[model samples]
Target chain A: MAEIELPAGIMPDYRQQLPKFLKDYAGRWIGHAEVRPGVLKHWADDGQTCYTVRILLPPNGLLSAATVRRLAGWIRKYALTGRRTCRQSFELVGVAPDKIEELIAEVKASGLVVGGTGATWHQIKCCTSFVHCQNAAIDAPSIAKVLSDMLLALEEQKFPAPLKISVGGCPNQCGGGTDADIGITGVFRDPPQVDEEKLLAANEDIGLLISWCPTAAIRPKPLPEGMAVEINPARCVRCSSCAQVAPGGVSMGRERGAALSVGGQGGNSRGGPQMGAVIFPFLPAEPPDYALLKERVHSIIAYWLHEARPGEKIGSLAKRLGWGRFLAGVGVEDIESLIDDYYPARTVRRNLHFKF
Target chain B: MKAEWQELPLCRQLMQGLYPSHVAELSQTRYPLQMYEEGLKKGVSAYDYGGYISIPEIPSGAGVRTSRRPDILPESPYLRVLGPAGGWLSADTLERLADCAEKYGNGLIHLANGGTIELYAAREKLVPLVRELNSFGLDVGSTGDDLRCLTSCCGPARCDLALVDAPALATYLGQRFIDDQQYPGFPQKCKSAVAGCPNDCIRAMMQKDHSFIGVFRDLPVINNEEFKSWLAEGGDPERLVNGCPEKALKWDGHELFLDGDTCVRCMFCINNCPAIRPGRERGVAWVVGGKYGHRGPQGPMVGYVLVPFIPLTGEEGFVYLGDIFAAFLELWSEHGRRKERIGDFVARFGPRRILRALGLKAEPQILLWPKNNAFANKQGRRGGEGNGGN
Candidate 1:
């Protein structure tokens, strides 16, 4: 729980902590309170504000007055439209002398707890969920707010390397979470199951309604006394097809749970679709209960975090290892159903998985 | 109408003026021997497809596809085959091709996709020798930036999971394009493809600027009409579900359902379940950007989802798809450059931006998400497949 203070300067790098020009503004009062302690806002000579935070937290989470004064100088001089709140340039300088490293380390490890800083993501933020948005399929922000501390806890140390993670309220992939390293997109696994006899009694066109499933998961079947219906678990990817059909369809039986796939990318910023790969078939865990997702992600990615050569993107590991070796090395007895491994049995029979 | 070649009388001697000989549907011995006997009957050798298509044959040589500079061809040579690829030399055919190279033209070989080997010879020299080479089981064809030999990954006999008749499709497309290789007023020598599946082991995605990947929609549905038949037919629902990596399928007793959302439209389920049946969604997602290593950003590429679902079974569908791609090029060629990859060109003048400029719908769905590994765990967008392995 060591705290580290960041040096201040706003050039390309913000690590210039003890600068020559701001050496004089170290111990002064900007408004009423002492610029050096407690809860006080200190404005640089240029009228740009900096926060001289006195932290009772970790090294990565604390800041000091000197750092604030130094940062304020640049913000006032160079920050474009600094008055706009979304675009504020306050520094966490004059940390309580007890927790600077802890503060900086947190920034390095958990992007959420540390907030946005140089080269790191702005924050592990989110929007309201089903309780909030009419269309939200899962509880997004609650999961975000709940897991926020733990997610940030890891940021207390330098990561194997920094990567972006985001979450969304629905399949729309909004908030740019689909492009992030760890994106939690909420979706319904068990769509509304239709009660055929009841629906027909209500004058619903079950035959035509069956055609609407994207995976063609619905089909009309004969029932005993009246015409009951059947649901296709094979073709249903829990995309609300049944719900859309029944409207109040089955309430999706709690939460049909989640499916985890990997390999999505916006290409290398250059170009390339980079479609994701399937790592887990389906995990029966409900949203707001992201403990499962977090734990699984930790295990599956542990090898990546622990074994990957420094600076190697997780994507490259799959390519270099070749899909077969990658699956076997990770003890994944089977992965054919993942990203369409159409490679025949003998084609890559070098491994035990292919006996032919 | 004779099927054999040795019966023709005389072919080469028929060239009274410019005609060299006849190579098509010969009547036993090539009529050339008789034509030659009737005096030096000589005319420039003609061909079947093009009027007097010349095959100015040259002496054999080893270096073909290896040479970068285009060697000047002899007058009247309509086509050429260019290179040393995967052991083009069978020992006998090697020397003859090389001798032609040394005596007739540049000592080079043209590497070809259809496995044709050649050196550039004078256009005039092509006509006469084309027939002679054909007699020796060799034929001359047009070789330029436009015409590429459409091919496959050998086939299941030598490969695996060659579900579709890949060789036949490739041959069809190749022969079809060969006739129109110069006909289509393409933005550039447009590329077309016929890959068997996603493995695309042939690297067809990277080679041709455009390609067709085979996909089959076989995820099971709880259609007792179908599922009962499948299960009654001894179909194990467990095996089917186990077969799908995406877990797009599951069996809850008598009910069989297709996890449609998880399915990528691959034909595995269909291949596995004969009773499950395949739907009209049986074709490829025509991707526009899959090139690799030209200016190298791993060759910035993305296989766009153009023509979402097509029936690879019908001629109307094939022709319709052809027109779809053709129509796209008709518009794209107006803005593209010689060096720009189709995707780059599309991005520069994005589908939306271009549509607006051209009064189109600005379709953004064409943006293809290429397969990448680096960011899969963090940004991967699949179910049960994200880094969180089930």
Candidate 2:
């Protein structure tokens, strides 16, 4: 093999010097990098070095063809490759160490933020609530954008630990909000409106519809026209299962809102992974401002910042301080309906009833 | 400590089966104290060892955790090999995997519950093992909070009950989202699966975050001749009629009649008798938010059907489903909190707003019908009261 010589303090122009196969192989390379104050570096398995350039994207995860083309050009120029990061950011690899500042500036010039690492807020994730999902009960992306903008400053401000906020349009939780430090999901306060005529026309079996309800909210009715499905308003959990099972027969109620959960984390660290608990179950879906929801989220974050120990996640912190004290610190007064201690145990011996 | 089976009631009961009068002699021979003493001499402690040895690490990707079994000798790391959809592995691939396991691991391959193959190897051999796996057009993943391998049930390839090509759809999805599987980027792990029919042998609707289940829009087609023959061959007509959940099936001596209006299409009748099969019109229903793990907010839950029916006809059908999936991924990735699962996300966010964002109209199919308030006027009043309560 010919010994290819490279200039000192500079990276070789691999796009020109390396064979197409090697370049293609490099393009398929996938990995992670540690970002310092203003520099990023990732190493390959063979001890190859590459500088990282981060490109933060919108919560909707849409990138224009033009933006992708421009990014490709930058990758070609640096004789590097790009991989999409888990936090919805694109990291350009194999950039020359000297070109870090240049690449950052170039990416910034194209109206993209270039920071999503360290103790700061990594990325906000939203589910396809009401966007393209037939099951969505709320507008997830819009709320996500709003929340992202609200917490934009935190993206650069280094926290004691990483902070993540997720939003889902409904309880399906495509956003995985249950495992985030701060999680938000949409909710419905009422049952679906049933059209008897449509229900009969669709040949929907009332028995199946009744069985589909998770909350036992559905029942069959003998109307003058025929058999129709009805919902028990008090019993309905608003899971939307009935509507999904019988499309034309049932529809979502008019009253829709958002719910807030806290202290969820996903990792193999202390306390393991945890799902978020509902701190506030009903925040009306008032858009553009969502003032109530924002205030509550901010309060939780503020309390976490004040109380959490360094390197401790929100879930762990919640466990350490006790959920009651944590709620008190966050100034959440309503606790009657709080469902923090209801995880179903694997083995419940119904027979063991001890008289206390 | 004493050899007295006569004194110990449990030992007497055990000896009653075989020893009878020789219970004392058998008890003397079984020296539990001596065995414990020997174990102690061999460095075996009565207490379980809880700590683990730190091993040298390699970065496969973000969120991938190398599992360690300290109890086993050599402390081999367990690597999950992403398999083809529906757990189908060709002989060549299996042979290569076996060879790799023999050369680099403990020569043991464990088929995991998550539909992936596990290879127990040394930590140092993982990267090279993965590299070799890549050469065979296979990779290792589904370890951490990323998209796990797309699983499926045997579809039209083998099962007559299959309404769609589940394996093919899974393969397509696996290929399309290979990056999502290889790269751990989500707040938490996202799992997906495809089932060919409502039978759902893979349990996709209960175990996966997102599941595409085969559904028949129309009624089940009953072959009268086949039904008659089945009936003549001891297939009880009364049993089949009663098996219908809605009591839609009626047998009048010679022939069977189905009341299509009352049929719920739960597949009970079809599953009971082979003579009846799913209708010609087939589609898939998208279900979301299912999870078996109880870590999150709502605890363990079965998925809710999101879309009642999405017609799967041709390339356009795949594209339509793909577009919906892509949209979901984008939304969840961009806005989801770190480590949040889709189910928990939906719980926090109301489904109404999600549907609005997706540009989907509010469909009646996604709502729960009230069982008690059957009368329209009563329901209207109750609904009004419920709104006021909110």
Candidate 3:
């Protein structure tokens, strides 16, 4: 192939343009290490061999500008290009094997992990929780950091299969947690608090508030000054619609925590893929360690590790073993509270076992 | 035993050269074969063989046919291909896919109902065809039970009603969960989607097992100038004023004012009028348990508003959402019964229990039906509430 000449007065030097520390690490490979095969081999359009280096980002998918700049530097130094993988990792293509080690070392020096592939815990993914989100009830990154620390050691351990754990700061699981090996989401227990004064000031459109509520949780009460809306705490899901519709008139309550679900595997298997189900209704968000929450998760994983057959995903194993046995194996004491069959049995009568 | 339509010429024609030969032979021995033959002869498409073909007694991976069309001697079986999130494909990619379709399969490409692409190819050609497609950076999957493509509406990219970047979020999710799209290892298929705002052009809440709907945390921002201009352009002021579900809009002949407290932000007004727009404070509402199929217990249900909102901003936003998705997938995979959709699972186990396990407070918004006492008067309160009576 003929090389195309660039017509430029001055091309930006991205590598030399980097800071001294980043420049020093250029062309060096910082190995984060992978238990499973991380190398990807593909042919270019010209049929030339191309090598791509994959590196796992730390849990929560946050990367500093310095790290990104160094990555860019590495890409520039190697004359390679980069793209992000679906698993929240970066893949730098067109690197030779001779420079792989150095490149990995350089990336490591930049404080980024290099492995999140194969039959171990992958990079922990999360949504913006309390940090930047106005609707988040718990600090999602804090929980993710703790979980990452707990599971990162296992990234190198060969398990029955690869596992993905996703966390949503709130129930609106932007992280795709519903279809992972494990999913965690924050929750709010109380209804939004109604600022009667604000409601009065905002024109107290009581009828609008009542009609907008998905669940008829808001009711208009005659106030001495003007109309005020009262939330039926029993019926409120705390979806924040009222607050959205009437901004200053309503606000989220103080009570907040997290929820845990398990066995959500997405692959073409026996019955296609399945959405994860909640194993625990609610676990108080105990920061730093999150002891009780971690224990339950650990117990579920332990049971699956011991009992699951080869090539069996957590969802498939749960099905094969029966939900009752699976719950028992996980050391769940109140199984009845967690599992109920009446509703499903009554509703889906035709093609009950129909596979997609 | 039945002679009503057996002797008819239409029935004879229908029986002649039926694609699946076994059904032809079974006609002689089966009891209801005559009824099926009658229906087929009466112009009911042979593909509409619904009740006659029984579902498998046990859920098995084998013999699963995605399309209703039978493969004849020269025709190839159908293969499903997944489209990019929001069904947005670049022209170059489309050209490649079109070339692959023409070369590998019958000269046709189908956009499936689940927001995926389909190509009809010989069974033998599937592997190689997929390989060819892989070269173009596209893959075939979303057939069996697994996470299908994550769909979204054109957010700020094209539509003015959008509150958040729907396509960006969808693409983010598509890239983040690409493996799940290719692999089918769950009890059943799972669908997910994102909508830029409450307009929900993509029907995320009803068709997807997991849905993220864009929402505003504050009241809709009304541009007085735009409102006045709209009024001048023959925008029916009386209709707009009386159209508010909560009667929140007031028109003083020349100007319009919004009663923020009374507005429900259902997007009706915004949808109706071009001048009014959603507020600046935007985020996503996580709704779960939605599915279109009726095979599950909760037959064709709309998702429950699981979380009122989760703000999408920066890298932390993506991380927080990813973590939550992973956790729920694990929980459902561990306990959900065979062929149980997340919606049915939520219905059976109850959203409260699901929320409890996830450490979410059980709020009234998750309830499928309003409580009987929702409108009932409190014991200590008189009828003066909201009445504005002295």
Candidate 4:
């Protein structure tokens, strides 16, 4: 056996190595304003201004080695940089005021858009999809790409409020889809199919599988030679918990689609942080061009643009007008899935004290 | 050592429109593309969701598990390196990371939505990779049922609207909870985040189990000169007036006034008009029980405002915040069930109980709807009060 030389695990202090302007104005930043749509100017108390130029990355946030090297080279050539954003966008900090245009043009030449500032449509973010994660019900990246391409122009325009969108490969929502203004989550309709042979072969713990099911959908079924688990389809919410616990034993069915949700906002500006309510519970996960999905998104955006007050986010607007009115405004039919069935007593009003 | 490669048609089709296609990126690495191609052929995923190596002989091996431990690490086990707070990486660091990825298991790197850098590697190579990463100020963890990395918005370092140093706070917390980040002792994964201000660009409130949001306790100060200059520079007064959610701002042509009591400290004014700056008295609000996972009885939920205001004087403020975090983790670990997330645990015990346990008072900020008891039942059980019971 060879001895492994382990180095001391200490993360470097990024503040020490920050770009010149940022290091100089680390704590002296007083105020900031959007110089333009994608460009920003941060003012220090000493009257020094630091400029930042934001650019959109690919929806899935996947960068090849070559592209990463190229970005690193640009960072060195332009202004030295700092932190990138949480969203699917990259920020180059400490850009000179005189060189802002040149940097934007150079970035554009590399085939990336400079936008996602102010009140405009932000870059769409999606999960790893089936590319890496096995739990993905739909190819989320493809869907996100199609939507992002169509909505690229909106990134440059000033909207009523900042809008963000996310796509989750599954309801697990690794991409925080439900936290976005418009959330698209993949969902499976039916319960998992139990393979008794595989379950026995794999020596899976039937108890673990049964316990993993949130709705108690799995039950121990004794066979002549071995024991297996059975899924109660009626009780299953299709959360993929059982399948995750016992992969080869409990598997999800093929009836899969996407769920469209709206009115979600992460900020505490108006209605505070709230998850998007599922509007269209099930939409087909069509590939290449998701016409039906695009149509619904367009309609929702149109209604929001026409009806919302200036600087009002979708969630706050929904809160003011009521989800029902917003639904009707978008011409969506009220369905059973649209209602919060978790607690019937809470959601359903007993009296006729309703708005007509 | 040479890496094997395969051209996957189905993966290529799925990644057609994507820039720097993931498939193309993986194809240049040691990642097994045949699994993807075979899975695509079978209309399912090549990697097992249950973290088992895919069995080739079984028909629809979706249910065919292997002799691998189901606890952690998949077939092509990947290491999730905790990214710098707010995704801050130097150009040199980026080049090193890229080199590391190519030199080790695979050439491709995934900027995970959870604010981590994921790189695929074989089980045997994990040790050497971690050692290498450690040499360059990087470490791998955030796997299994442990404390995940604390992600924060780029605060005062980048954004001017920041009320507190969000990245600094996150880094402080991360350092304090380093042991938790490395060990998998918790009942379930605990995620945390810090937002610079009310404009939570990181979506911390709805995505993390515990979130600290930078907030101002006082009224927004108006710079009269800046205001006039902004107006002179074609700033829309109508839009600013109309955009106020609380109607707290009023302009009588000669002067612009703000109703202090009406303002909720939402930061809308500060964000829209540069003249309006956040009040000096700033601190972080502790919000707990937020999660995006649709698991357990209480599905997805936004966190409750546990503490409306925790005055942050300096580095000592981090100690106060850390105290609350440690207390909550202890409470959850003691009472929570196996595989139960903090959000579900909080839901079962009720926010009132949680506040009481933490020795905190319930403020009006904690209430989503004031004086609304529609969700309460005759038994006095609050909404979201039961465990696996509707």
Candidate 5:
């Protein structure tokens, strides 16, 4: 009579158990257990909350879900087994398209969301940086992690159009950072502003040091004034070219960061498929200093999202919009301060009817 | 109000959705389609040339979902069609699609990249409507990804830059291979586009999975006397020689001498020279994998030269290209992964791998021509010898 009958389809207070569930999963033999079913899942591996997912294959078949999730995930999971925070992807082998929705519901109920779809750049990929590659001129891994965090939100939201970004430590692109709407690479902004004391104290061997340059950009000298070696700076491609050959060859300018290039693609449109061009000389974006980089990327994305057609690539937009318009629109008044004119020696693209 | 897509009610949408099959399940449901039809019949067509639409502005969101309308019910009977280039046209097809909208249904034909005609119809009328359009040789369906219309260059009629006649090959091959104009299981969708001349006016460089373009080996020697007469009668020699990217031509006042080896045979000069001609021994050049979209380690690129196989004149040639493509499909579908276009598919196992997978030998002749950077001279040459090749 007191309406005690409707046993209250009350809110089942379940969120309170999240902490208990977390504690139980830790240090327990909850082996291969998935909280939610199919695709997305929240799991505890070695007592840490980890995100696991199932990727759907394209209509073209072959994929369990969509893309490099399994590929990128396998790289992170097996290759980076000890890391506390990890994202893992599993291929859903034999699932039908109609079942995707059903699996999505089960996964969402358990918590984690799927990765890389619609507008987001595929994944944050990095190659062995300066520590491993002979061709590496700078530290690419540090810059990659910085970029990954800087553009994390860009991964989930749908855009008026899709956008991509990449970062390369050296001229050889280890990180796809430079190919995106924005890119960053390591390079010196000026003649390595050296402390004369720092060079001499390092037992500078100028000859063997300079030999490390592929571009022969550095030249040593016996100067009367006290400047032992001066760099051409023009030929320097910002790879530890001179530093590896000569001791104290250069300090990464007075300030060190990464050089940025944009719109690298291999295509036969507007501009023939070619390497990305440098947009910023060097920005001091180590870890905490990503504010400027974030602002620069956000401004660019906001403009591009409004302007670009669905298939219009970033390179064409960068080219057609020119450095002047691009910089000006983004309110980057100090173009040189933002980027170095490494292209001064390059000539106008005179597409000779014939190539020699 | 060309086909009042928005006016069609939910019930009529379901009707049109069911109308295009052998079984007429929607025959009993006609009231809703009739209601939408009455509203669409009210618009007036005042313009003749420019339809309040251009290539880019044409409706792209059609057939985006099960219904022609995306936000509407998932099973709306609306249908949107795709065609070559989406807007790829021979001023004739452009005019015809435009006319169909003006006269019968709403003159709204949206073009698609893969090439084919897609029609939007009301549920009640879709049965009779499809049959009516079929009389004109138009088929309604999707034309992206797997199902596409075989594309061809406008060919010799408009361009002076083509090395061979692309239109003819496209017409011939299109007629032979793509009869049903429907999807069949293979490595993605098979794209066939022909470039009449080597200049590839039809974008064969970045289209068709299997592209056949023209190439010339020998230099086109000028009939000096005839060339001089044309020059005297106002032909530009600089335009003719400069047309060649190789700068393979030297006009020695009396004659035009072509540097035979430098003749990448881009037809710039041949197209420009009134007295010049295509060499008699000329033939078609075959290429594969010319898609230009997205990138990984290897991104989208223009077609690579497969083999400068001898020109095929009739049905035999179509069979040659088809068989070669079939071999490629067998290898790629079996080996390639998702998001891999043909080039990436080939690059994955290696170009040699692709060739071996297709049981093909690496023909040196295939490497004879560089596929990209196929250029053309923008000179306005009226009429001349393009067929004369040696």
Candidate 6:
């Protein structure tokens, strides 16, 4: 075998770059306690303590160049080490307890919020809505902004447990919304539309489009001129696979809205991590205010606050009380769509276990 | 320099009120927001999603993937640069990263959900960009059918609840498997993550194929002094005592007592009550086959805990774990079908058979007891038994 020259870069050693205090207490942290909503105090074995201040970012982890430069300055000034969290937030590590107030002020002055820790609403992770992606059924970023604006105060409020929310433009779910406590995914009630002219002009492989449908909804039809594809409305799940395959040939239909799913979490602590189950299969995604989506989320959180045990995640509570009773508690009517009959083999109920 | 751009009325409306908006930030990027505006006008993606132009001449191991945007941009293949495993970056490095983003490719640097930073650049400029990134102490990888970036939470460096040094472990495994990260030789894309503890702040157990989770076997330790102080600071004892999922906590007036047998170490008590801390004995749990994609037969799945506990001894603690991981990857690449995700493969091919193939003994942790029916009563068997008849 010949020696291959790999990419010349090695990851910068964080130990050499991190703040002095963090380097000193690299693997010696004993325990931590939340000082306030966004402040955390960690103790080392030598009794030295350091505080961490968390700053929140908007959906999709977007940051302007100016904002990035300012954040870089903050990282250089307030605390030497900064980290981008998995949930689209930033943390200023190794802050002295006394300087936390100053850092928070600096962050706020720069049009940023400083709370995503403790039992409150975390950042709303949304995928690129109509801004960049062609698969967007609903204006996800606008709706997410509405939700974030309404729930901004709750970022400090102590709920029964922390709530994670995600929004997807289409069912492809580029945002991984199904893994969140409250997942809002764009759905198409109708099937896709096939353009005969575009289909013929693109010269797409008709067989490929016919086979790529997850539900086999797309089928070939012989027109007078050539071959085209037709979609079966009942059979179609509107997954956008055909649209992605032949961009000019096929596309999703106009009838679109958002679906609300509840009780999903990624943590192994409470219920060992499960995908959220759909409660409301369709809700009108009116941008700028998204009143329906906001109302549904508020209702679910209210029910959680009223019923859930102190540290019990909404998913764990739903699992304990059963989805039927949990949805009823949120004033939701049990409907056929909630049962998820899409995959009949995997979801059939066999036993007599009922929580209703 | 900012490019010519026009923010839509909807984008402007969304950008109004509260914290900064993703729309505003996106508009500032040099990714041709005008094309997006055109997309909104036409109700379809301005950029084509068709398969990338095949470039067979370039080496397969190069850190590049084809990306094409019809009518607006030329053939610009993107690069997937590995992010810092520990999620730490110096301020100077961040500035240089922005500079790099502006200098090469589109001005936008996409922080992908998989923890890789993506930038769009033409094929001709990829080698120079990789060299520049290398000089800045960053590398390009985590694309195609190979090992993805090993992401980890900020462990003992800043977090107090961390039981293991997550960043260290991630760095160790990442360096050992650097070849895997750079090469496109796997049956399909493989992702891995290391969570410092079971809190799973990084969400590896639900999303990654290979997840190394920090675990402890003993009950949480309670400090009476801290408990009294916490109560004095208005921490509700009733909430803390009743919130335990396992009901393992008991408050006998002055001190807190725990039921050792009943406690499952779910971190509920330790999370709510700062007075309580995790146990002494700590190690990493090797969980495999978790994924978030809706593709494949099994759909999304939570990884099965293959080995309940693997002790961390010293600086070279991950060597043994790396050996096990490498062997599993080799086994998977040989047997797995093309484009088949690991979770689906594991579900189709039983976990017991996988364990047997790897020459490992299954513990109770590896079993999915009762086999999807709540009424069945059966004991979970180790590997070698026919999945304990229910």
Query: Residue B354 of candidate 3: its Cα lDDT?
Result: 60
True-structure RMSD, every candidate: 34.9, 28.3, 29.1, 5.6, 28.3, 4.8
Ranking by TM-score: 4, 6, 2, 3, 5, 1
**lDDT agreement with native, every candidate:** 0.40, 0.60, 0.57, 0.75, 0.43, 0.74
Comparing candidate 1 with candidate 3, which one achieves the higher lDDT?
3
Weakest lDDT window of 10 consecutive positions for candidate 3 chain B: B49-58
**Model 5 share of native interface contacts:** 0.00
Error of 4 at A18 (Å): 2.2
Return the TM-score for each candidate structure: 0.34, 0.47, 0.45, 0.89, 0.42, 0.87
* DockQ class, candidate 3: incorrect
Name the runs in model 1 displaced over 4 angstroms: A1-356, B1-129, B132-143, B152-176, B179-189, B196-203, B216-245, B253-256, B268-277, B296-302, B352-390
Task: Encode model 1's per-residue lDDT on B1-390: one tens digit a residue.
Answer: 122224323322121111111111111121222221211111111110112231113221111211111231112122344211111122234345545544464333332223234344555555454544444434444333343334444222112234343444554455444443423344344445566555453444544566666555443333567667768867778867765556777778977677777765444465455444344345555556544212211222444545444456543355555555556665566666443446655555444443344333423434445445565322212332111111
Residue B32 of model 2 has an lDDT of 26
The digit string of per-residue lDDT tens for model 6 on A1-356 reads 99996434354455544777787787777777768877778888899887778888766766655566777888777776778888777787777677888889888887788887877888777776665455678766666778888787454378877889888878767566778989998888788889999998889878767765657788888998899888888887777767766777887788888888887888766446788888898898766668888999888888898898767778888888987788788878956667655677655578998765
Worst 10 residues of 4 chain B by lDDT: B58-67
Model 6 ranges off by over 4 Å:
A1-13, A129-139, A153-156, A192-236, A239-254, A286-289, A302-312, A317-322, A329-331, A343-356, B1-7, B40-43, B50-77, B121-125, B370-390
- What DockQ, on C-alphas, does every prediction get? 0.01, 0.01, 0.01, 0.44, 0.01, 0.45
Error of 6 at A100 (Å): 2.1
- Best of the candidates, lDDT: 4
lDDT head-to-head 5 vs 6, winner: 6
Model 6 Cα lDDT, one tens digit per residue, B57-128 = 222224432223454554336677788876786787677777777787666666666777766666777767
Worst 10 residues of 2 chain A by lDDT: A7-16
Candidate 5 off by > 4 Å: A1-356, B1-62, B66-106, B122-128, B141-144, B156-165, B179-181, B238-243, B295-297, B368-390
